[model samples]
Target: MSDPHYDREAEKYESPIPSREHILSFIQEKPRSKRQLFDLLALADEQKKAFERRLRAMVRDKQLSCNKSGVYRPFSNRGLLTGTVIANPKGFGFVALDKGGKDLRLTSQQMKLVFHGDKIRVRLLNKKLDAEIVEVLETVKTLVGRLHLDGKKPYVVVDDRRIKHNIEITELIDGCLDNQVVVVEMLSSPTIDSDAKGKISSIIGNYLDEGVEVDSAIYRHQIPAVFSEKALKESAQLPTKVIPKDKKNRIDITKLELITIDGEDSRDFDDAVYAEPTKNGWKLLVAIADVSHYVKEGSELDSESHERGNSVYFPHRVVPMLPEAISNGLCSLNPKVERLSMVCEMYIDPLGELLDYKFYSAVMLSHARLTYTQVNEMLEDKKSPLRMTFSNVTDNIDFLYGLYKTLRISRQKRGVMDFDRIESQILFDNKGKIKDIVASSRNDAHRLIEECMLMANQAAAKFLQKNNEDFLYRSHPKPTAEKVELTQKFLTAIGLTLEGGIEPESRNFAKVLKQAKGRDDENIIKTVVLRTMKQATYTPVNEGHFGLAFEDYAHFTSPIRRYPDLLVHRAIKRVLNTTSREPSGKMIEFGTHLSMTERRADDASRDVEQWLKCEYMRDKVGENFHGVISGVAGFGLFVELSEVYVEGLVSIRDLKDDYFIFDDVHHQLKGQRGGKIYRLGDMIKVKVASVNLDDRKIDFIPDFG
Candidate 1:
């Protein structure tokens, strides 16, 4: 094919042979070398350089690739894939394909071209699925880390382990001292020969200072910590108490002896519940804070809440989605206060099946603010002092407990997968240091409130579906085949099996858990089973939640904290008072954004907890403690201390008189020579070796003479 745009090229350049389009079309069928192309085009010596420059530009733009043998070929769309880079601290990385299949592995050399969380295109190498970076679509622009000074050279060590490279500090602000946590703005991206360069944008504080972990996590995860001035102004203007106009056309349930049951430390109460014995079975009323009533759509408060998505609860503090003026003041369902609410009233038969439900706006008064401990004591013992103290709500507690038992029967019959994992509470001293870490027990009171909230959420989803309204559903898809296979292998190694062959329901998992109960390795079995399930997320497509075993489920209970619940509140109101329907496109956008924010909050909180745990163990080095093998990896074993509820790693090298080999299927390390095995769930004594605050890691070794 001759140069079709040769005349046009000649008008732009003095020595022009063919346009880029012409050259590409000619080489599209078969890749050609530069010399071959020069001979084919019959180009003069002077024009060769210009043509070569074009080829290099095309290659830079990923339009073409030059093989090692010097052949230029156009990229086939099938040969390239787009994905987000998931980097490891070890310098190797993987690309999670957008369309969802097995991830493509990237070598350390290739990982140097892109940072973690960057979206990029990769070209498949072979059947083994190794990939090469083709082009970066997006790059991480900032990082959060601690500043380090090596003589005159200043650099930043990123807090996120997934980011491997140490960013060179090109500029530092005044008063930004070494070893202090700071946020860095990327000046240049990393390359094969050099590290990424950045400037200290803002100093968080001293790395070891009290409450610095929370601040660092906020910046590290890019979570918005401060509300906008407009949002604050709007919140400050909100009324402290519910006005009479706010109760217009809404049911007045202020006289009902409804009560809130939460943890002892909980401050922002969003839900109040009441139950009464009825002829059919029971009548239950769940009143949630009407946050939507005050935070109108398109208002600054609403915008700020949407951005936050949900409250981020830390061990010592909380980053609320809404301002305190709304979340803890006007919208909070505090005791003896008139508060606007969105109520879900349900009628259930003796069989525990939901018979009828209705949703409406209401003015509710919480008669008492009860803690879980108080409620449990009142329900567990008739002569309990709490019963005498809260005599007014004694009948209400009995009614709620009866309803909860019936609901438990229904939940068990439906095969709800329950993982009775022991949760730990990190109690802090007055000096803001960890005083003690203890197991937080869950009682019947907790179950009662959870069941009530679940019913209300279900009713909300059912209501929206019946009205043909588009909204976000809490969706939990089935596990991937790969994860399921690994889990099955682990189960089989332990003389157990997941009942479902390929596509199993929640009941199958519940059955496996039931069989594993009372066994010594029950926690191990439950942990492996839990790992096989997919994470639940908000989506407009309504895939249904596999974990909760719900056909229809939406968050309708905590509008004061969760954005999806707020959105659910708005959707319900739209159906009740107006005929307007939110577009499906907008719903999808909201789902994705809210899901991301939820994950961000989880990551930030986890980071803070890990840092605190590391700090707590800093002074405990050389002390021996017994622990259970929580995890087994090729390099080490992760053990959780039975006494303190802290986790640390015992490196394979630390094992005595054995060359350990990792057994992935059995979740253990086997000795090649000594025949000693360190398996998951095995209790072993270990001595604390060291703690790294920067990495939030603790090292332990076997305590042996």
Candidate 2:
């Protein structure tokens, strides 16, 4: 083919070769080696040097790509793509494309060359978009798993069930035994002919050892659970109590009846609340620990805090972002002690609309430390004896309760999402054995504090946004079109209607949940509706929070446990002072890191909870319980026990008498011959058949007999 821009190239260079456009066109038809391209283009020997230079430039510019064998091809989407591999234990995977679109499926055979979370280049195999791994760009260095000896040779079953390959143990450390949880360092990557090989780096513990679940989860999720030497030293150097200098140049709100309300077992108090009736409506003050004041920017302590991002709360343990001295001591708003804090004071009308707000550094003394239950008891009954005990703050609590009701009304009017999801808390006996898993219910007191924090966070966002300053905002985007369509189809299949036409608001979701109330499949409808929403994230750019129905929002509470709140405190300080230095770091990158850390903490917590739940079910085999089908997959139906809240899979193979076909859109399985159907949210009786501690899996079977 002739060069399309030959005249342009000729005018630009005396020794011009074929234009880039012409070269790309040629390679688009078929990849050509440098030698073949030189022969086909009929370039003179001297011109070959210039032609090679042109090819290099084209490759550099991403117009073309050169393979290892000197083969050049067009770098177009249809031919090749780069993405992260999302692996499945069922022996298949998908590529999450860098440029967002439908994920390309990788068959079991094609997945052998890569590990989960590996970034790789893939070539399109056919029209169905089946992809073959072209090159692995990155590999996960280490994995946490249980070691097992198959007769003589040893192998590891990865803790993350997504990775299906049993890695061969090339070297095992001394004292490591069979069925022990260990961390393995990869020695060789997987290939079509052989499995991955690794050496044991460290032994966590025996698979069933007490507290082994927490240890395994910490390692598996790569959560930084230990404090660094420098950070600890920094913490030690700080004074044990609030000093006079720390309170200097701060507004004194010590006389105000500010009280901290939290859970019964809570120790690290991050915020305190005070409220009074104002002429407009009400005056509310939310005082957060001034962590940025102590943990200076760029300090070792700050670095440690930023690395942890947020505290990880397990069943009985907490991986705190700050050291105990800061998180549980000086920064904590303990009762009857002077504490330095960053305060957000807001004035609102009777209708609960925020009218005006002010941010300032303050020195405050908490009058009382209250629990949610105590607050609820005091507010619910007029003659409650506890009211007299906390008389110093009961009036203040009443004022706060009034403000909470107003804010709740405002929130409802604003169309905020109210998901009535029940969270399970695992109870352990004195010896740390599983006792029971109970639902943690939220009451008005919880909502009061939540509303208070929401208002403060919203004020902080508005304060920074109005100043035109760059800061991280808690962003929750609207759901994608694809998810909405799927949810619509599911709702339609169930004879339900999502109110909003296409782009629904939070109110629309709330309406659906209300519609599903008391129905047999209410839980299923709630789960599906919840799944349609997008995950909230932290970003420098302000995208309004969809779930909270907030036009402006940032996390300004819990600086003691969250790094972003610390950043917000610093930003507020900078805006409040002309000489104060702004917080350091690229805001965009910081947001991304914090978001990932949040997810990491959640995953680690979930891992520990799953292990505990598996252990809880180990002794219940053969015991039948009533459950609701929570999830439907081609392989099985996941049932959540009614009272215990434990989930187990009822495999399709155990569903006797017929071959079942999975209906993905309807979320059900239909028997091909008998026409028997099992669906998500259908109530049924199931017996605990087996439990796999290593995999953290519980298996159940239908107990019709």
Candidate 3:
């Protein structure tokens, strides 16, 4: 008496069903309705219930999903987007969209299913761009962390704060111990329901071990520490000295009395300079190491150099972009050695304007290697020991300083913004622990080299533009309108005005800085204006450099350490030969990649420096020091100690007298009950309360007592 269709469906539910693989293969070939899937799999009448259960299980596993019309398809085909997950330290995460749309935000619950840097497929849930993780496509395979043992249970707390989950350890490599820093390799990636599993690969060292801080930073940031065998082999094959054939079409400028000026610790000399007074004004020759001559394009060495983007300079060491064989051996501008170079011969008029410039390959011998301190002494005192030591080059040094002054005037007239912020240099003792932190002084020697480099960069940009070649330009965009408005409000609070209207040029900002030069708040004002500007990046497009106020600029020096400069050398070569080059699209992609690598290097360097600073301050807890308020937040003020240049938080709760309100517009924190205010650049005394090495954080309290 029941319907015949019911009888048939019931009969089908009694038959044996196909395996998941068989069903999935059928669905993958082509999407189908449930009825069609049953027919396609050729299931018996008795298999209907089993088939339905299997379909539901697949949907639950995110292998398949059903449409509104009740048609089944692969989950990836159901309008899910793929992206890399960027997790926050507070548990939330965002999917950086691959197709260049707005990022999709994931809730804490959704973020639990995947780790930071995991590539996943996501589906938007609402108009707010909130997304649900459909599937994890790829997981971060390696991590650096501290090993911990809970009784007999072992695990790793990853150094990257964004990776919220602790990795359970299944095994340990030789020499690994609890509380030691180790690198772990993921044995199993996290799923929707379970945590990740890993095995310790190698032990870096103990938490408080000497040099371990720098090692931890290196691993934490995933900076490449060693070159590949192929790259090293290529470097080894490079000639120990420049061959005679290499100089065949190169100009001979070995008698120009060129001198290399660099830091006392510098080993790789990338550039040398010489200047002389000409009939017009001056002739300057900047000879840069011809790295392109040794590291040919598309070679293994070139590939590695491009991947590095630029050399990373840390307090105690450098991660050079090229191998030592090339960077410090064959290509370094060593004194009295004939080396190949790419010279930028520039002519400047009496008014500091660039009259003309020509780029050519040449051979040169460096007369001497000079340090900044030595050169400064020679300039300040005629009878200085350095002056007597390098007597032959004293006349040339004087002329270079004269040219630098002219260039400085020109730079000021062009409205270039210069922020005179104090940079700290960490000095290490014999045991490699920090001896002291001192302010890095910049004198005329540094400025002379900088202006020379700027001129060469501008010349390169001009030459490329004239030839209509595709190349990477160093471009700095102006500040956003919101930031500009905020800056204006803050400046007005300080009784200062920003000239040139709402769309003021960089010169307007320069004027404001000039007005505050001798004021007690000069550093604070400069810091604020600097924060309101955008970071410079490499681009194929010819946007002007806003900070430098240059209409066109390109990095053409230091090819030994920067990949962009090497590429620039290649581009210049092609232009000189009148050869057709690659299209602009390719250069644009390369520019974007190089810019990211540059930032990667910077982040790694900064991470190491922070860790070192934290270690240096660990012993100073309970001590009092003078500090300046460097940053203000809703929760606290960040005070940078004047003695050690280390910054720590002064929590709002410690203010004690009243509830404080953060003023975003004026960049200050005001107390409601006490009517007290703490603003940026306020000099105050503070006592260090505690240091947390685990979080690399320090806490401070005002010395009100």
Q: Which candidate is the best by TM-score?
A: 3
lDDT of each: 0.89, 0.89, 0.86
**Residue-pair clashes per candidate:** 0, 0, 9
> Best-fitting candidate, measured by lDDT?
1
Write the residue-wise lDDT of candidate 3 on 98-206 in tens digits: 8878899988877777888899888776688888777788988788889997556798988876888888899988777779999899988764456789999889999
* Per-model TM values vs. the true structure: 0.89, 0.86, 0.89
Q: How many pairs in model 2 have backbone atoms within 3 A of each other, for residues 3 or more apart or on separate chains, i.e. clashes?
A: 0
TM-score of 3: 0.89
Write the candidate numbers in order of decreasing TM-score: 3, 1, 2
Worst 10 residues of 1 by lDDT: 61-70
Ranking by lDDT: 1, 2, 3
Worst lDDT run of 10 residues, candidate 2, spans 576-585
Better of 1 and 2 by TM-score: 1
Model 1: per-residue Cα lDDT over 387-485, one tens digit each: 888888888999999999999988888888888887788999999999998987789999999999999999999999888787889899988888888
Model 1: lDDT to the true structure: 0.89
Which sections of candidate 2 miss by over 4 Å?
A: 1-83, 97-104, 121-129, 493-495, 579-585, 657-661, 670-676
